[model samples]
Target: MPEHCAAFSCSNRRTIASRARGITFHKFPKDKDVRKKWEVALRREGFHASDTSVLCSHHFNQGDFDRTGQIVRLRDGVIPSVFSFPVHLQRLEKGRATSSSRRAEESLSVASQDSQEMATSSPQPQPNDVNISTLNVIS
Candidate 1:
């Protein structure tokens, strides 16, 4: 019987070695029971198993790994897409800023329209009667 390793470091070291060379190695335990245990551990740490191989911190640093190679486990227990926390947050922030700016622009447009209406409705003095008496008094 093959001995089972409980620590992830062993698998991680091997994964790193494989990734650094741009090659995949099947060093991880292949037994169903061993895989089940690993899967449980990975899930506990917010990881998901999909058709593609699972990667640890070591695999992430490798040259062969890219955004397309990453994975995220969704709330519905499905591995939906690639995982990049920084990228995700940046997109969210940008969207929020854009929405806020749009709202501000709309409000400004409405205010300008109201101001125009007020200006148009207000009474205007005739040119000949405009402020001559006030100017004389000031002089």
Candidate 2:
């Protein structure tokens, strides 16, 4: 298929041959220290692999690199962690704002309904007895 996957040694050969040809490969380290460094870097970059037993144990033992410089089986199928404090706060603020707005709208609606009812129930002013000349002068 593609030039990159055409190489027989490429692990993604089958995937590349398929209709969905995109394959992302991660490089693991052979050196233990280097592997640890890579795992630490991933952790720093908000990759929460600590909760998973497989990833944590692998990274703890062999770092991220195996004997062949390939990424270890650890941390496979783990969803990327999101560590955005600002985004979380923004979501909370938006929720609060929406709730407050809804409450305010409900209060306004109730007040309007009350006013409508009052208007409907109250006695209307008489056209003949009212002082139109005084009302015009005040306006």
Candidate 3:
């Protein structure tokens, strides 16, 4: 089986075209700390990198690689940091946003309440709306 990029939305495969495009594939680092960082960058909950798992160059900055040698290699201690994760798949920063699980539930509940209010509520009369009958007309 062809090795595919392990990133969530990346579809890059281990093919000649990919190589030709200068997109080098990299294996997860052997260092436990570095490998864990790579896994976290993937934003894949409960994801663990297997022996064959790889991430494409597209998920890393150019500086992360060492291209001075004949073969492209990742610089020591570097982690994959570049990715185009969708909004929903993005992680919320601690203390900056609500937790993902609670955010979805809260948003849905708020939306439902807003819809209900819209359906039953009439537009309030503006201050400019006058009851002509209540005004004494100067004949």
Candidate 4:
């Protein structure tokens, strides 16, 4: 059987054309956690990567590769991040990301307010006090 890409909707296979296009296949990581992350990134419901399962280079950012050697390799802990997910899956991912980012922004805002309140409440300049306004201006 011809080896094929395991990602959903991916038609890449090991062939001369694919090689010419710089498409390389990567095996699922041996570390269970990293492997699971790859599977989740695929967004295929209930999908589990078998030992022989592979994802194509098309599903990863160019930065994900380590090319110091003649052979290309995925950097340790790298998870495939690119995909052409269906509209419904894309919408779901966007919704989740939006909510998560909103929560993160809220947390950062609250922290900033707390820091400002603490700074204002201090009547005396601390020995360690550096001007935040000056830092902001320099930035």
Steric collisions counted per model: 0, 1, 0, 0
**Per-residue alpha-carbon lDDT of candidate 1 for residues 78-130, written as tens digits (9 for 90 to 100):** 22122333432333344425878889988999999999999899977778876
Candidate 2 Cα lDDT to native: 0.42
- TM-score (C-alpha) between model 1 and the true structure: 0.25
List where candidate 1 sits over 4 angstroms from the true fold.
1-97, 132-139
**66-93 per-residue lDDT for model 2 (tens digits):** 4354533434323222222334233334
Once fitted onto the true fold, the runs of candidate 4 whose alpha carbons sit more than 4 angstroms away are 91-139
Candidates' TM-scores? 0.25, 0.24, 0.64, 0.65
Q: Alpha-carbon error at 78 in model 2, in Å?
A: 48
| Cα lDDT listed for each candidate | 0.44, 0.42, 0.89, 0.89
TM-score of predicted structure 3: 0.64
Q: Which scores better on lDDT, 1 or 3?
A: 3
- Candidates 1 and 4 compared: the better one by lDDT is 4
Which sequence of candidate numbers ranks them by TM-score, best first?
4, 3, 1, 2
Give the per-residue Cα lDDT of candidate 1 at 32: 58
Question: Which is the winner by lDDT between candidate 2 and candidate 4?
Answer: 4
Look at candidate 2 and give me any clashing residue pairs.
29-65
